[model samples]
Target: MIGMFATSKAGHDKDTVYIIVQEDTEYVYLADGKYKDTEHPKKKNKKHIQIIKKESDDILKEKLIKKQPIYNEEIRKAIGGIVCQKQM
Candidate 1:
């Protein structure tokens, strides 16, 4: 699958980047190297943003498999809230 990586420039001045796995539009957040969950206003919940300090490509691949779905759901819920806000 194609994966696109991008960074968020909103808060903490933290180096937050996310990979979008093309097959299912899954998102995996990486910060530092290992996997960690941090809170950000943009995230639907605290776990939506994860910190990965120095993970290898192989490790990312394995973690991505499980993290993708959870991230995707958080994104969906965040977007839904935005749409609902606009409607009202």
Candidate 2:
């Protein structure tokens, strides 16, 4: 489960932004503001979800790559600090 944050200029409402939730290695797009409980049918785990603003595939990929290390570190720390943890 990972949460991705992005900014999009093509939004209809200035106060609203799209959110993409990547759960179980699947990406789900949520474009109904930020408080709505959008349905993601393509998700596999249903539990692992991500939230991000809607954007082009290239932009999304760029953001994901930029934040991948950060997200990975967070996940490692969350999972008993085993994946990237250093032995002491």
Q: Rate the local accuracy (lDDT) of all candidates.
A: 0.37, 0.33
Per-residue error (Å), model 1, residue 35: 9.6
Query: Residue by residue across 40-67, what tens digits does model 2's lDDT show?
Result: 2122222333223323345434554454
Q: In candidate 2, what residue range of length 10 has the lowest lDDT sum?
A: 75-84
- In candidate 1, stretches whose alpha carbon ends up further than 4 angstroms from where it belongs are 1-5, 14-56, 67-88
Query: For candidate 1, lDDT tens digit of each residue in 1-88?
Result: 2222334444673435544332323444332222332222223222344332422244444554554433444433433443354369
Among these predictions, the greatest lDDT belongs to 1
RMSD of 2: 14.0
Inter-residue clash pairs, candidate 1: 31-52, 32-52, 32-53, 33-52, 33-53, 33-54, 34-52, 34-53, 36-51
Candidates in order, TM-scores: namely 0.25, 0.25
lDDT for 56 in candidate 1 is: 26
TM-score of 1: 0.25
